[model samples]
Target: MKLKLRVIFFLIFCLPGLAILGYSAKLAAAAHGLTSTGLTANGTIVDHERQTRRRVGQWYCPIVEFFHQGASYRFTDNDDCKQSRHDAPTGSRVEVVFDPAQPSRARVDSFRGLYGTSLLSAAIGLPWLLLGIALVVRVR
Candidate 1:
């Protein structure tokens, strides 16, 4: 294959894949940083805000409450489950991970809550990356 064509194809396929992979890695690193280095406390699943999306149908945003330094902080989790998931029902106990400087900005210390964004991004990026590699190798 022509060098220009190869370079163009590599840019088209590899660039976005690498960008996404880098972003996913950054997200995962942040999540891990908060989990391993931030403060931790026991929290409760207070409620869930019902939400609807076009084509994605229904979902629920979990509301959680926790205490840190004699202060109670409540916030909706950033876990994006695009379905009626009752995995963590109201009154359930969960681990809350938070930064000491900003307790209000906390998250549930579950697998999905901690790494969902990264996992989702990797799901999109890894395959695209592999396809790009395969295409570039076979583009003779």
Candidate 2:
């Protein structure tokens, strides 16, 4: 009975914690790669809008436009958190960081825009990981 419970606890906590760690690592690696090798350009906030969600209320997303190699590209900010709409007002100029080889793969050059996912993932995953470790120690 005790062995069964230990196995159940390990499965419930350790497996998910490992998965979260993997996800967070992937996010951090991607952000590092972009910030290290990407090119920067001045972009304009072309549009700002709010998306309504039942659980979280409203999230703000901004659309930005920039020119690269004589061509124009527009991309929406990936942040969907509340108050994100207020971060960039329309017509405001902002920095854009993009892959030189693929201009379409770009992001707003801000801490939140670039590292938010990785930060959030780490924040959530760290506690789960600690708890899983504690549980494993207790089982042993």
Candidate 3:
């Protein structure tokens, strides 16, 4: 009975926590790589895409545009799209950091835009991981 409970609990909590932690680590690493090895350019907020969810309500995601190697590239900001529509009005300037080899894949050069997903995921995952570890240790 004790071993069965431990297995069940580990399967339910620990595995998912580990998965989330790994995914967040990957995201953080990508951001770090881009910042370290990418090219910097001035970008403009050309548009906003309206995104809605029941839990998150509605928010506008900034669509950014920049020129690289004489060609223009546009990419949606991948940051957590929880900001108000007014947060980034069109025509506003933003610093863009992109892989020079793949300019289309770019990110807004801001702390939140670059690292928000990783931070949020880590914050959510760490507790579940700790709880799962506690459960396993206590069960044993």
lDDT of 2 by residue, 106-129 (tens): 898888878888788878877887
In candidate 3, which residue ranges exceed 4 Å CA deviation?
A: 80-83
TM-score head-to-head 1 vs 3, winner: 3
Per-residue error for 134 in candidate 3, Å, reads: 0.2
- Between candidates 1 and 3, name the one with more favorable lDDT: 3
**Residue-wise lDDT of candidate 3 within 1-140, one digit each (tens)?**
88998998899889999999999999999999999999999999999888876787888889999999899999998583646867788899999999998999899999999999999999998888889989988996
lDDT of 3 at 132: 90
In terms of lDDT, the poorest run of 10 residues in model 2 is 79-88
Off by over 4 Å in 2: 80-86
**Strongest candidate by TM-score:** 3
Q: Which sequence of candidate numbers ranks them by lDDT, best first?
A: 3, 1, 2
Report lDDT (Cα) of residue 33, candidate 1. 89
lDDT score for candidate 3 against the true structure:
0.90
